[model samples]
Target: MKRKLIYLFFLTGSFIFLSAQVGINTTNPQGVFNIDGAKDNPTTGVPSAAQQANDVAVTVGGNMGIGTTVPTNKLHVNGTDPLRLQGVGTGNSTTDPLLVIDANGVVKNIGTLGALSIPSPAVFRLETAQNNFLQAQGAGGAQVVPMSMIKNSIPGLTYNAGTSTITFPAGTYQITFVYEAQHNATGCTISSYFVDFPLNATTSRIHSTGAHSEGALSNHGGTITYATTLPANRNWTISLGRGQSGNCSGAGMNLSATSTQILVFRIGD
Candidate 1:
């Protein structure tokens, strides 16, 4: 049986039922079932803006839309408020303002940051959206730190573990290396200790010297520092060794997790 209930007028709280396309309060139905809402005063102080034309309207059906007939998301807002998200120095300085959503689904502008804190080393690492000036990482042992540890790192530098070399592209750079070193006198006669930055070869050296004496209980410790220009395609290795006058000259020296470590960082271009 073919049936239709069509009303060419607008009304509220009206209902019509049939196994056909029912147009309640209007001659046109947009969906399988459509309701032509009544002409009423809009929040914009305009009349019939809901149906007669596009104005401030709260529409709801399959998808809820604000000022739009075609809703692309669950809640689609078609027009701009031009006032929301307006402020200065938000979510930053101690006195800056912030925009936050409340439990009542109202957006409130507050004069403080959120209460949440980033508790992990890997989270919220950057100080700002554009620049990273300092980087820090802590390790328990004397493990070799590779470039992968930097959450933000610029290019043109390389580290080779096999040769203990750091290669930099032809440019002037200020390199800082800090280390703690100590050697037991068990291997050979103690003379002097040294930490060396050998560029290209051991003969070309930058040295930090320390003192030592003979005894199993005697261990000498100090730091090594160096800075220079690296020609294009040049590499350098940092090393720790006993002084040439010591009996341990041909003997090898090793660094333990507790006894020794090297901290290296680039200060500038």
Candidate 2:
């Protein structure tokens, strides 16, 4: 009887081990190596139900998904939480830098947006009021009489009232300076010159009117014109003078508001 019983017991144990579902924490495992336990890797003596399911897969490459089973890209992220990239280390000294990759595979932070460019349009003008003039008197030789008022000026041009000068951007420019001047010098021959109009650092002749006679005063007026290429980012001023030739020793020159004016034109680059 003992021999027969032992054989039956061995047979029963063999059938259970081969046919029954292999499980560790529980009597039955839903799939191979469930999260809770597995046949090959089991809970040992611990007790817990294995994971409910398994897709039978492995991470073939670097890309892996979180909160997702089927990852579409490397380190794919999912779920309801927002993702963000953070900066590390000092951007130049504790200043956090924006992330960027260089051509040589170097990451760094840069100050400033790079270089800047300013636009320059051709064809402009700077004109003063017709009443603009200098009260120049006591003529000895050529004298500089600065234009006093600016009615209008082009963009990128600034006029200084204290210096009577206009500063403009730096570039090669075809500029022309015009001046309308008048003098009221009694008893002597009167002449008008454009000081700084030609920008010669010397007086350029505009127009001259001879005296009528002694005690006979008449208005004398004329215009000066000079054109050429000028330097950029420089200050320029146009002035009107009287008795530039030193002929009107005893007479004085006055500019008229009705006829006196200063006009500057930029016709080329």
Candidate 3:
């Protein structure tokens, strides 16, 4: 009977131990928490050492390296190599860069440029003027001297009497004319040559003159000189007429037939 009682006691202790173990299993999820190698319940919710190391190795998004870094937008690069884009070929060498557009885009490597257009035209015109002399006197025959006469006397120039033009096609020119008075034994006064711009009738006048003794000879002359800028094309013209002086007489001394007048024209830039 005693042995039977002892056996019952042992069985009761076994049941008690089993019930306590079941309660601990149900209540304690981690089985046992540790701090400095001492057994205790975890006061703060913190991953164990093993769990923390695993988290660092396989981060929530991925590895924290260049290629494995998390992307903020659709177009992104791996953390392993920042320059490399996702799904692009893998290599250290740079590939043809893809143009990335941001909220405010950027333009690069554009060259300098200049504008172009057509030019405008300029305006131009021609200018003309005249210079001459005229001499006349009361109660006597008159004479008119044209600028052309002097210009023709120039050596390389060809004078056109009818057209009152002078042409210097080849050589240079230095021409001059002057008028001097002379007294005649028959009481006649010589007329001095003069120049006049026929275009202006009223104001046409003669240049300064000098008088000389008669019975011998009295002559007057003027000068006109110029160099041909263009030897190939050169022409000029002038006109001549008799002068009126108080003692002048056309009967005794007549103006020479070769003594014609002329006009000069020059063109240059």
Measured by lDDT, the strongest candidate is 2
For all candidates, what are the clash counts?
Answer: 0, 6, 57
Per-residue lDDT of model 3, residues 81-174, tens digit only: 2353478664311112234435533223322110111111111111111121223333322333333333222223354444544455333222
Per-candidate Cα lDDT values, in order, are 0.40, 0.41, 0.31
Candidate 1 per-residue lDDT over residues 188-215, each given as its tens digit: 4444444445343233344444556755
Worst 10 residues of 3 by lDDT: 114-123
Q: What is the lDDT of residue 71 in candidate 1?
A: 48
Q: Each model's RMSD to truth, in Å? A: 16.6, 18.7, 34.4
Candidate 1 regions exceeding 4 Å error are 1-154, 176-182, 186-190, 194-203, 245-254
> Would you estimate the TM-scores of all the predictions?
0.36, 0.39, 0.26
Candidate 1 local accuracy as lDDT? 0.40
Tens-digit per-residue lDDT, 102-169, candidate 2: 66434456532211112222221223333323343444244433455544433455667555666654
Task: Identify the superior model by TM-score, candidate 1 or candidate 2.
Answer: 2
Score residue 220 of candidate 2 by CA lDDT.
56
Clashes of 2: 6
